[model samples]
Target chain A: MKYHILIAFFLLLTNLNKGFAGGGEGHGQAFDPAGTAIHHISDGNVYTILDGIGVTLPLPVIVYVPEKGWDMFSSGHFHPGHHEDGHHAYNGFVLHHGSIYRVTDPTFPAEGSVEVQGFEHELENNGGKDKDVYYVNFNGTKYRLDARSTLDGGVLGGGITSFYDFSITKNVVSMILVSLFLLWLFISAANAYKKNPNKAPKGIQNVIEPMVLFIRDEVAVPFIGKKYPIFLPFLLSVFFFILGLNLWGQIPFLGSVNVTGSLSVTMVLAVLVFIIVNVNGNKHYWGHIFWMPGVPGPIKILLAFVEVMGLFIKPLTLMLRLAGNISAGHIAILSFIGLIFIFGKSGESLGGSVVGSVVSVPLTMFMMAIEVIVAFVQAFVFTILTASFIGAATEEHHHDHEHEHGHGHA
Target chain B: MTGTLAALGAGLAVIGAGLGIGMVGGKAMEAIARQPEASGDIRSGMIIMAAFIEGAALIAILLSILMA
Candidate 1:
């Protein structure tokens, strides 16, 4: 049993290496550290099951162009020179590096041409903005095919620049799964309670009840005080959902679809907190933010501006922190795996790969173990802060405490 | 040269985070030793403060990535 476990772990590590390496040519024989690491963490148009084996699940590609009106097709249509389809293009729109773009050039060089590479340099020079390399906005401008699409090292002479993309990405699918899983788990737990009238909580109730209570008592009650019950459900759902997704990302096969690591997911979560805090804020909350009772008129105005800024900054920090940690963790693991290939290629010897694997694999495993603890801790921290923010907003300031403390000064 | 600079930036962010967390941990331990009864409250407060420091460091790291 122990040997089986060990072998399974080694296979998991090897498969991960292969999966990342297969994204580019040369299969698992070569590795591009930054490219591989980022590719693994970032969302993809096609769900890759086994890259080395050439088994991929293509997602639906939906695009809306002003001239073309609407172009909807399977992402498989974007595959380069397939035996079955011949060419992957719909209404002159080509999918490149997970983005759809129009191609006017009939004889564009294959993706990765020297001309395309030169265009990329020019594009970067023209705009210093942090462009999404995978999801480029089509603005009816002529792009050297290489600049237009990462896949086809060719050049796009000219194409439509503006198009609305509403395709269901891998992250979106993972989010749907997460939502359904939470609904199923919570509903069943609730049903158990309803069926049996509180006779020493059994099964799912036993597992979930304590966590619910912990959020209520440790997180909610201490921060929120009397109105703890009002926000308990929100706090519980946020905590469990974050925790579930974090843990889900650690599962061997499903490691790629880390929904929490995505910036959009974290931003949405932060937006919910921002909306709830502002919408549910009592008069006292607004009073403190806009006009402090004890402060002078001039100082009050300055403080109010700072307070208003804090409202936006608080949620921004929340979004960045979760996305950063989760994505960084995944990147770190992939980079460690990439180290093995780096050593192997550098010295042109098997000894380096062997030595590197011996060091990197164990370290990667240790990091993965830490990630499990991080999963729970991040969820806990997010929950507690949300509770605290809500608590601060709803809390009625007690002048009585100030009066009592003022006695000491006297 | 750019890679080296980015690595340095990432390293500096980690150092800042480590120092901040270390201070929080050290002080919290001392507080617990001095007043064991209030340790629970001290620990929770320490975690929140540490999280804020972590959030700042994460932003720094992310900005460095974009710059690189």
Candidate 2:
């Protein structure tokens, strides 16, 4: 009875807070939904936990300049927002758009200098109030910085950066975390199996052993046949790694990094698969691609061109498919959330915002639920396609009828 | 104006994918119903085909976004 009352009281408190939030009238500018969505989905140097609260965790920026050797510092030096306290430049380097660049102009702010917020007036070409500006020189070009980003108003006419950035941005950090977790999960499962070789699995072993068997039996054996063992490890790792990152992205508070949505990450994953497929291909595969034994000369040439083109196209499609699916899901959810603010602007009243939220909140939740299923389905599809590719490459052609033909001829 | 056109393109892509995946699912169900013992094999094959259809749609949508 005490627990029930406590739960009821908490629910009422939340409802009251929601009411108050919706009760406010038209006083502030509508939040830019597209900008917020893009910021959330894109790779960033700082992990933003809550945009309204201005809570963010800055990552480390690592860059190498041929002339400067090495410059390493926390991304905090970039000063995430005006409210946040930090230096804008470190060792003549500045962070812009998740990258680091070197400043060359002597008039530019030096290391540990306070950030000037806004576009510089002198650099402004248009006839208007001069905007406050920070200048950064990259290579032989000059660039200006405003509060939000490096704007194009310098000698080069666009923002330029010369440093080789090796920063551990938000996505990189999340990848490391997911990798460590996977290592721990699998290693512990392996240890458990080792300790009890003859017994049935328990705990994490029981949970993981079934998944491992599913990949072996459903994906590997049927697809790769005798060479199943050779590719099982890669297939399992890809499936779980994707699934882990996808599920992690669903976490609301972690400011979850969209690893799979990033094109470069997907590209690397696809390229690795491409390498494995080609390296493991057999004589039959190469023969089928380059020279058709039975086809006419003209047709064979056309087929060979198509076959070679297919190799590159396959990996490119894989990269785009995964990135597109993941990013689309993120955008859909964010757009739904943005509807409330949009309605607030249109109606010019709090009631419209409340109605929009009421309608959109549940729909966003529904989309999120679908995303959870997509996460699993995409991982399964990637693994199965990879296995099938390997299977095609390594399959051996049999000529049993030819042996019988020799007997008949004799 | 370009954004609106891009959204229309995405919608058309989704419609095509919806039709293609629906056909795949229907065929898979029919096959499974015919041979219940081979349901697993049929389901996995259906998923691969559905994925291909989705890949086509996703590529179209991505192109529209990029163009916009």
| Top-scoring candidate (DockQ) | 1
Off by over 4 Å in 1: A1-16, A22-30, A50-54, A79-87, A91-123, A127-161, A346-351, A401-410, B1-10
**Pairs of colliding residues, candidate 2:** A118-A132, A119-A131, A119-A132, A120-A131, A120-A132, A120-A133, A121-A130, A121-A131
Over A6-101, each residue of candidate 2 has an lDDT whose tens digit, in order, gives 556433323332311221111243455664566568787777664435576888877766656776788776775522223365666565433444
Off by over 4 Å in 2: A1-29, A82-106, A118-161, A346-350, A400-410, B1-8
CA lDDT, every model vs. true structure: 0.68, 0.71
Displacement of the residue A404 alpha carbon in candidate 1, Å: 9.1
User: Alpha carbon lDDT of residue A260, candidate 1?
Assistant: 90
Candidate 1 vs. true structure, TM-score = 0.81
Error of 1 at A363 (Å): 1.4
Q: Highest lDDT: which candidate? A: 2
Report how far off residue A106 is in candidate 1 (Å).
Answer: 8.1
Q: DockQ for every model, please.
A: 0.54, 0.51
